[model samples]
Target: MTAAIRCVLFDFDGVLADYDRDVRIGHLAHFLGRPSHAVRAAIYASGVEDAADAGLLDADAYLEALGRELDCTVPADAWVDARRAATHEKPPMLSLASKLRARGITVAMLSNNGLLMAQSWPAIVPALFPLFSGRAFCSAQLGAAKPSPAAYLRCLEALAMPPPATLFVDDNPANVAGARAAGLVGHCFAGITELQRALEEHGLA
Candidate 1:
């Protein structure tokens, strides 16, 4: 028999919010007076971001590295502003998270993001603040990125949730597979409608 799901671990970017890379880059570029392509290359083409996500760099180190790459200082506020500008909230998804909590199912976020994002979640997604307070886990803090079993294990440990009783929801199939590999129930999120149905099947809705 399937273990009853007592917790839901969700991915933040594509699943909880609509992320626009262009908007993020554009905001950074405008803030720093640099070209968009330059900002994009500095953030993506360079290995700085990957290192940050993988926990190889701390927040201060990450920003200093970005500043070196862009040849301009990157303060925490500007970075947070750019991130906030890029993330548009999905009311349906936020509502679903709230509903899950109301149903006695714990809701948390496990995102493949840097420590900076972990610190900025309240400002980035204020609508989710009440529901996910103290529940959001970022890859940098976990010391492992998503699609890695270590990431799921660390998050589950932090939440004090057993893998068998946790449902992992992500927009990426590969991430879902990783969650399954880590002994948690996995759901590949396609849309809010489908997710609602899936929750119903799990007796969580």
Candidate 2:
């Protein structure tokens, strides 16, 4: 028999909000007075972001590294501003999360992001961030990135919930597969309509 889902873990960027890489690059470029391509290369091509997400760098170290790559001082506030500018909320997804919470299902977030993202989530997704509050788990904090079963296991451990009774939702199939491998029921988020159907299967929607 299938265990009832008591908690729903959501992936932040692609699931709950839309993140525009171009917008983030542009914002950082403008703030640093560098060209957009340079900002993008420094952030993405440098592998600093992946390292940060994997807990190789803390918040201050992450910023320092980014600053070094961009050839300028990257302030925390400026980084937060760039992140906020790039994150756009998905109203339907937010509504679905709220509805799940109202139904007594615990809704939490788990994202493959750096510690700065954990710090700046309130600014990035002001309305939805508070709802996750203490339940928001990031890869930096977990010391592992999604698509790694360790990440899912660590998040489940923190939640004190058994994996069999939790539901993990992400836009990435690889991440979802990792969650499933960790023993949680995983749903690949395509759209609100499809997600609702998945939740319904779990008796959540």
Candidate 3:
């Protein structure tokens, strides 16, 4: 049964890496001279991040919108730096992905990140990504951010594989449940050790 699985889809942010929303919010608020709570409310409460992740807004458009919400013009690099501030890549998981690929399994990223992540993250950590074999897919590029069945379906279509043969891993339980609803095996990521255990449980690693 494990042999039937060919592709492993990983979620970024809380899984492959950790991000500091507080730091990001602080940076944005300081740069825009807005209140800290305002930054958080606009991004999380206002659904602006979702809109950007779903590709309703491109990087520039997203920036423009964010600026409008903050009532200031934000430098592109500032936005990038804000997001990148507390980003910590998980080397162990990356190494595991490399090992999986070496054994002929496909390891790809499915992140709910905006175009800035697609553009800036690679530039920020050019070497951290080569392990995934350049098979990275972002919500901004796909226009179907998860928790949506469309996003999972799009991934299967793009990979040219059936849902039964794919495994989706994410830190968010909601996202994991969404993947399961889409007919793919879903693993809610807790930590590197748990993820390694999960891969072995599924005979992937």
Q: Output the number of the TM-score-best candidate.
A: 1
lDDT of 2 at 156: 86
| Sequence-dependent TM-score of model 1 | 0.98
Kindly indicate the candidate among 1 and 3 with the higher TM-score. Answer: 1
lDDT of 1: 0.93
Instruction: For each candidate in the order shown, give its overall lDDT on alpha carbons.
Output: 0.93, 0.91, 0.81
Q: Give the clashing pairs for model 3.
A: none
Q: Per-residue lDDT for 1-205 in model 2, tens only?
A: 9999999999989999999999988998898899999888888999999999999999999999988998899999988889889999898888898998988888899999999998888887888866788999899999999999999999989989899999999999999999999999999989889988988888887
**lDDT of residue 132 for candidate 2:** 87
lDDT, candidate 1, 1-205, per-residue tens: 9999999999988899999999999998999999999999999999999999999998999999999998999999999999999999899899889988998899999999899988889998898887899999999999999899999999999999999999999999999999999999999999988988889999988
List where candidate 2 sits over 4 angstroms from the true fold. Answer: none
TM-score attained by model 3: 0.90
Descending-lDDT candidate ranking:
1, 2, 3
- True-structure lDDT of candidate 3: 0.81
The candidate maximizing lDDT is 1
